[model samples]
Target: MTSGKKTEKYKLILDAAVKVFAAHGFHKAQVSKIAKEAGVADGTIYLYFKNKEDILICLFKEKLGELVEKFHLSIEQTTNAKDALRRVCEIHYGELEAQVDLAFVTQIELRQSSLELRKEIGKAVKPYIVLIEQLLLQGMEEKLFRQDLDVKLVRQLLFGGLDEVVTSWLIAGRKYSLSAQIEGTINFYLNGIKA
Candidate 1:
């Protein structure tokens, strides 16, 4: 196959993996199920992934990489650190809300994987955490946030806060709008970190 077709197939598999993993959870999701969802033969999955765990890891790396890129571009459009922070919240909530299956895999299914898989997944998370620190630093430099705040700690808090909201939404059967929480979540974090 041509490189383009190969890339397309890879993406198809990842997309299908998200649905399968979300529906069945990681432990119960099988490579064959993902292959069936992708409409590819069982052996084809092995061409792109070593196993189900690899599919989950690659799925996260691809998905979160897109998220980090989105955050970067959106932050660039904002004039102030506060707006940039708000953009982060909006994009984070909006994207996940738009793709609840991905959210299900990310927030719920990923946790059931082995520690090594979790660590691999954390590699993708680090860039988003770095982005949070950058925003915090920008806020401090602009005198918008506390000067004495530890960026490291604050980044964890901010990311954790955003993550917890999503996890809660997922746990609650998504009865509420995930996007609706954006304003309040931003307010809560901004209040905690503001100058």
Candidate 2:
């Protein structure tokens, strides 16, 4: 069984890995560098992670899992679909705006992984997509969204659009606040769906 100390150390290593990877890129970041950043011995990294790829995958799991859980809570707090969507945007853009390392790793370095790693990352992202679909379905049920609208397509559009906005912002060296675009983003999608 893993002790609380072990769990805490694991998270520390994972957090350090984010900065190391962001600074050096995933391929160039070594286990020793991450260990040093975490203030642990080089061998301690092996105890927590199998390799660099494992560290990257674990980082995705930890970060995205936290975001997905927050999405669940955000949807629960909002009674209306539009409000829930706006809340989602708030969390998305807000998190990116709040953390430079997270934004850099997610938008740029994460995409540098191999196809297999990308596929694994995609699978890990399904829960968040399902959450979006559920919110869209709720809108349809309330007659707030068109009855004939495609939930899957709309979810894809919402996710893809928001993702592109963040990606573009990161690619531009993050000149502006991503959270500032939340309302415009909601209006852009909500315009077509309003019933």
Candidate 3:
């Protein structure tokens, strides 16, 4: 196969793997199942990934890399730190809403992987956290956020809160719109945490 065809095939397998992993947790999800989902021979997956764990890692990197780039570009267009943060929250929640299955794969099924896999996920997660930290620092510099606040702690809080909110929505069967709470949630964070 040409390099372009090979790359397309790899993405097809990865997309199918995401669906399969989301439907069946990692332990129960089989390579054959992913292969069937991808409409490729079971051996084809081996060509792109060493194993299932490799697929999970690639999924995280691809998804999270896109997310970080979007956040950076979105923030660049805004001057106010709070506005930028709100945009970030909006984008994050919007993504979860738009891609519910992928969100399930990410927020829930991904946690079932091994500790080593979790460590790899942590490395992929750093860029997203850094985006939040940069916003917090900007807010602090502008006296919009509490000057005494630890940037790392603030980053954790922002990410943790948003993550929990999304998880809750997913757990609740997505009965309500995740993006609907953006204003109140942003206000709560800003009022309580800002300087």
Candidate 4:
């Protein structure tokens, strides 16, 4: 197959895998289901990925990379760390809220994978972590955040807090608006980190 066709099929499988994994948790999700969803033969999935775990890993790598770029662009024009931070939260929450299947695959199903798989997925999240850290550093440099802050620790706290809010919303059946919590979440984090 041509390189372009290969890339197209690979993306199709990953997109289908997200839906299958979200609908049926990782271990319960079958390669056949993903293949069926993608409208391809079961064997066709193997052409792009080794197995279910590989599919999940590739999915995270591709999706998270796109999200990191989105987060970067969202804050590129902001003059203040506070606005940048808020933009990050809005984009993160809004993206997840808009794509619940992707949200479930990310927030819930991803957690059910093995430690090795989780670690692989964690690697994909490093760029996002760095983005958060950069925001905090900007806040400190601009005198918007405390100078005595532990940048690394604060990054973890901020990212963890944002992550939990989405997890809680998903766990609760998403009855409420996930994006609506953005302002409150940022406010709570800013209180602890602000100068």
When 1 and 2 are scored with TM-score, the better candidate is: 1
lDDT of 2: 0.88
Segments in model 3 whose C-alpha atoms lie over 4 Å from true places? none
List of clashing residue pairs for candidate 4: none
Q: What is the C-alpha lDDT of each candidate?
A: 0.93, 0.88, 0.89, 0.91
Give candidate 4 misplaced runs (Cα > 4 Å).
Answer: none
Error of 3 at 39 (Å): 1.9
Best by lDDT: 1
Cα lDDT of candidate 4 equals 0.91
What's the true lDDT of residue 24 in model 4?
A: 86
How many clashes does each candidate structure show, in the order listed? 0, 0, 2, 0
RMSD of 1: 0.7
* Residue pairs in candidate 2 whose N, alpha carbon or C atoms collide under 3 angstroms: none
Ranking by lDDT: 1, 4, 3, 2
Candidate 4 lDDT tens digits, 28-56: 99999999999899999988899889999
Residue 155, candidate 1: Cα error in Å is: 0.3
Indicate the TM-score of model 1: 0.98
